[model samples]
Target: MSKEQQIHGLRPIIEAIENGEEISKIYFLKEGNGVLFNELKHKAKQANIATSYVPEEKLYKLTKENHQGAVAKLSPVKFADLEIILETTDMTANPIFLLLDGITDVGNYGAIIRTAECTGVTAIVVSEKGSAPINATTVKTSAGAVFNIPICKVNHLKDAIYLMQAYDIALVGANEKASESVFESELNKPIGIIMGSEDRGINPSTLKILDQQIKLPLKGTIGSLNVSVACGAILFEAIRQRMF
Candidate 1:
């Protein structure tokens, strides 16, 4: 589907799903509530659809009309689950996946996936709701790398991380505010990195549960790097350490 065809909102999206139209995922504001919304979520779960809960600004961008604080977009491709991706063989070894906590910008999402494919990361996991829509913009931004990479959608990013931890995988979360540095950390084992959206970094609840929270070195005045660039830098470092 065309990127422009990706419409987002509470009522419109839920109706689409009820009518049996395929949707990539639905985004709900953190404080949002209603019978319709609740029913939609229940149905989506029953249908094995992914859901993401995010802050307010994200819903505003999809449309100015009465979006009711929600946005729905169609993913050009389907997303898989972390466990399934991990179990699959012959694709890649020493699996490395990226989980975006609540990134909503299409460009950043695409760029990260591009870097993931380029750096040999096995798959990218995005929370069913808050991540960018795998629309034409994302496809274009990714330079078609989205097609080559395996992107999965999970019910909750935390549960997905827990699944990895259960498998003996180590998690590395990046935040400008984090004390530890990524360059100094050990990432040779099966790994997953959690990245936050533009407005806020990873959720504190998620951060508190991670194995390691590492920060990228920033000598500049801004003291922050775009999430995509930060992910590429970290993923490449892992590739370098593994290759050599």
Candidate 2:
């Protein structure tokens, strides 16, 4: 972890949280506890920041200086609010949104953002709890594209979907079992594309809410494509349709 990435000590961590810093997670000595530690932990929980207990050796490895038995990892970019993005969206144009469901890989997340930016996507929505942390690695992997696009973090993806639906944006998902091909799907409409994690495709419950599900036809022996690659393919299709 980089020095710029971590905030050490209880008082400093508390102040950072109070200052509205984007803290990804907090780590504290497993055995350490006191009024200050409890306060820090309480503050982190209230802020919805993940917290973990680590050994002294781990803290030492993270920083040689005094950490006061607590350290917090900061997100490189502040997360955007979904409601705010929707409120400011230009309803006149056919908006294109990308919704990531449980995608935890930072590299894939970064690459998806890069593609979304290139394709002129309106915004990328992700669940605040399950989404990957936008750290230095994600920023670097995106080739700095992470900074160019608006990424809305929502409490639940379903809520974002419902909001977009209310705005007349169709929900489209990329699924292997879908009978329809992505190329055949109507991409010119105001739509939101849903991409799932590597382990599981879209959650079964989420699939129920999709207005349409699309599949990318494959001729080779390979069964599936990486989530990032799949995202690029679908986004470019939308771009092509919108351009013509």
Candidate 3:
């Protein structure tokens, strides 16, 4: 973590949040207690910023400067507003949106972004929490594709899903147990495809709300594929459908 990528001290962090900065996450000392710290916590919660309480040692490792028991990691790229993209994008072109559910690995997230951009996805959406931070490593893994694509962070994945539905874009999720295969699903129209974390396929609540669920057929003994690989397969299948 570079000093340029982090904002140290409680006051600076609070000011950054007030200024609508794209903060990836914040670390706070477990033992720290003060009026300003409480105010910071309130503002962070209101902004839906991911935060963690850690030991002072963790803060020291993050930065040698006087952190005042707080440090915030800044995102490498600015996040796009989901509602704005929804309103401005041409739905007639069958724009495809990729929604990530609980994807915490920066490498996988980056690879997914690279694949999405290559496949002509309109944007990528993630939850404000549990999703991977768009850090330096993510930028490298993405091959600089992160900046090329619009990534929207929402307070909750469900909220984004509902908003997409309001836009009349079909919502589908990638699930191994889904009855329909990705190749067979209707991806020729404007759609939002949900990809879950590597460990958990998809949240049960999230899976229930999707307009449809899709799976990639597997002949080998492997039960499932990597999230990024599955995303590529599904996205390309969508492209194939739209092209023909």
What TM-score fits each model? 0.75, 0.94, 0.98
- Give lDDT tens digits, candidate 2, residues 1-244: 7998899999999999999998988889999999999999999988888778999999999899899999899988777887788788887788899999998999998899999998999889988687788888889889998888888777789999999999888999999999999999898988999999988989999999989999999999999999999999999999889889
All models: lDDT? 0.79, 0.90, 0.94
**lDDT over C-alpha atoms for residue 146 of model 3:** 96
- For model 2, the stretches where C-alpha displacement exceeds 4 angstroms are none
Task: Compare candidates 1 and 3 on TM-score and give the better one.
Answer: 3
lDDT of 3: 0.94
Tens-digit lDDT string for candidate 1 (1-244):
4436666666677787788665776777788889877776777777666667888777666666676756676667755656777677333356687889998998998888889889887888887666667878899999999889888777788998888888777888988888878878887778888888888899989998999888988888996888888888899888877877
Best candidate according to lDDT: 3
Residue 79, model 2, lDDT: 78
> Which regions of candidate 1 fall more than 4 Å away from where they truly are?
1-22, 25-73, 89-92
Residue-level error in angstroms, candidate 2, position 240? 0.9
**Residue 188 error for model 1, in Å?**
1.5
Could you give the candidate ranking by lDDT, starting with the highest?
Answer: 3, 2, 1
Instruction: Write the candidate numbers in order of decreasing TM-score.
Output: 3, 2, 1
